[model samples]
Target: MRRIVQFSTGNVGRHSLRAVIGRPDLELVGVHASSPAKIGRDAAELCDWSEPTGVIATDDIDALIGLRPDCVVYTALAETRPMEALEQLTQILAAGINVVGTSFVWLAAPRYAGDWVREPLEKACAAGGSSLYINGVDPGYSGDTLVHTALSLATRVDSITVQEIFDYANYDDAEYTGAAMGFGVAEDEELPPLFLPGVVESMWGGPVRALADGLGIVLDEVRQRTERWFTPERIDCTMMTVLPGQMAAVRFAAEGVLDGEPVITVEHVNRLTAAAAPGWIFPPDGHVGVHRVVIEGDPRVEINTHVSHPLLDPTDAACISTAARVVNAIEWVCNAPNGIIAVEDIPQAAIMNGLMWRAK
Candidate 1:
């Protein structure tokens, strides 16, 4: 069994911790929590498990590194703290431990993440002979993994689009929903970081570039577009409140253009509530989150993936899926050669383990 260190105890991190503790092939070694209350608590308490696993959460990175886990499942909030997260990942890599997590959003496609983000991780990995694999539901599977998987059936490919249609009100992060996503903002206010120029390219462009690379096509440019819808009535979610006339829904896309045509595109349609954006796209269920991949070619392929959980909301259930994307890849990441290992590097057979059989 590979020893694992779970980083952070946020929405995604909590699920990662549970996956590590529940899996028979994985041993929970250490947990890194940023919150003061969670730092000294048992891992079970953080994830709602009734029994303790003899593992406690700590904020000391050095202490966790000293544990020498085979891999660290990093689910920290990277969207707001990209540089800090990257630095921590490098530190973990330099300590000679493999890392598989959802923190590094841009690292999902390193070539487009720019040198500032890629160089440090490369140096650290080479220095300590460690490896890092970053993946998530949208940037991880929906965009690159699932999109590519569906493209396999296309005889002639024209354009590819991956859309994440979800209600963000269910996502329980006030700062993320308010500041980062620009939800509940006035019409005259400035655009939020997510919609600002170059931000979309920096975050979602990874999949666009990866798709371009996979198709053996060089994109002339990666462009971004965003639009918002205002809520006519006040609405409240688990995290923040959206007042009347505040921005409630957003539709944005990172497009890979070749000869002025968008060949590969990543689009996101998010609403504070399902009722906010009736005109925009929604899943067949028309209730929660769904990732749709559409390929326009001779034999067009369109797949809508609806992720759910018995005890969790659709937004949180997607987090569990995101954690699984990286957690399940721990073994492959640990066994691979040291460096920033991409999804293409890991074989499908190795990554598909545990899905067919349930462990008692």
Candidate 2:
């Protein structure tokens, strides 16, 4: 079993914490939380378990580094704190812990990560002989990995389009929905950070690049397309609300062009409510979220994936899937060569232990 330290217990990290405790192949050495109230709490209590884990949460970053576990699941908020997150990742990598998580979005495809961000991590990896892999549900398992896996059956490929169509009603993060993505803004308001120039390319473009690289297609350029919608009436969700004429939904496509055509693309149809975007795709079961991949070629194909559980909504279920993606990849990443790695660089990433077995 590999010794591990979890960096945060936020939206994604909370699920990661549960996964670590249940994963028999991993031993939780320490857990780091930023909130003062969370400090000194038992890891078991933090995850809602009855049993007590001796591990006590700490606010001290230096103390986490001191534990020196074999791996660190750095699921702290990166988009909200890129510079600080980068600095923290740099310190952790330099300390030689094999790191994996969704903190560094661009590391999903390090080749596209800007030098200012990628260079320091690369240098740290070289100096410490460590490896880092960064990915999550949207740009991760459901987008890039799913597309890559679906392409194996294609005889010839022309265009690959991956889409995430989901209602944000259950995702109760007002700051993320209203401010970050402009889910509840006035119709006359300017584009929010979610649609701001370069943000899409910076975040979703890595998946496009990864798909193109997998298919051996050289993209001539990358482009963005966006459409915004306002609610016809007041829209109420689990934690937030959007008044009439507010930005209720946004559909944006990030495309990677090859020979004047978009060969690889990632599109998001995000909304405050399911009824907000009728023209966009939706799963038959009407789950809160669904990720779709369309491959146009000799054998035309379309596939949709919905990940959820009895106790979790589609939003939290998606988070759990994202956590499982990284947790399951822990062993492969730790054993990999010192550098940044992506999903394609590793094997099938089957769940560890005897959770799933094949018949001889």
lDDT of 1 by residue, 208-318 (tens): 988888889999999998998999899888757889888988888899999998899899988887778889877775568789899999799998898887878989999
Cα RMSD, each candidate: 1.5, 2.8
TM-scores for all candidates: the values are 0.96, 0.94
Runs of candidate 1 with Cα error greater than 4 angstroms are: 355-360
How far residue 74's Cα lies from its native spot in candidate 1, in Å, is 0.7
Clashes of each: 0, 0
**Error at 265, model 2, angstroms:** 1.5
Candidate No. with top lDDT? 1
Local distance difference test scores for all models: 0.86, 0.82
TM-score of 1: 0.96
| Residue range with the least summed lDDT across 10 consecutive positions in model 1 | 351-360
- Expressed as tens digits, the lDDT of each residue in 1-360 for candidate 2 is 899999898878988988887767788999999988898999987877667879999978788889889999989878878899988888889889889997677776777778988899899999889999988888787677788767877899889989998888888677654677887788678878887888888888877877777777788988888888888899888748889888888888889998888888899888877778777776667677788888899899888898878887888888888887788889888899998887778777344543442311
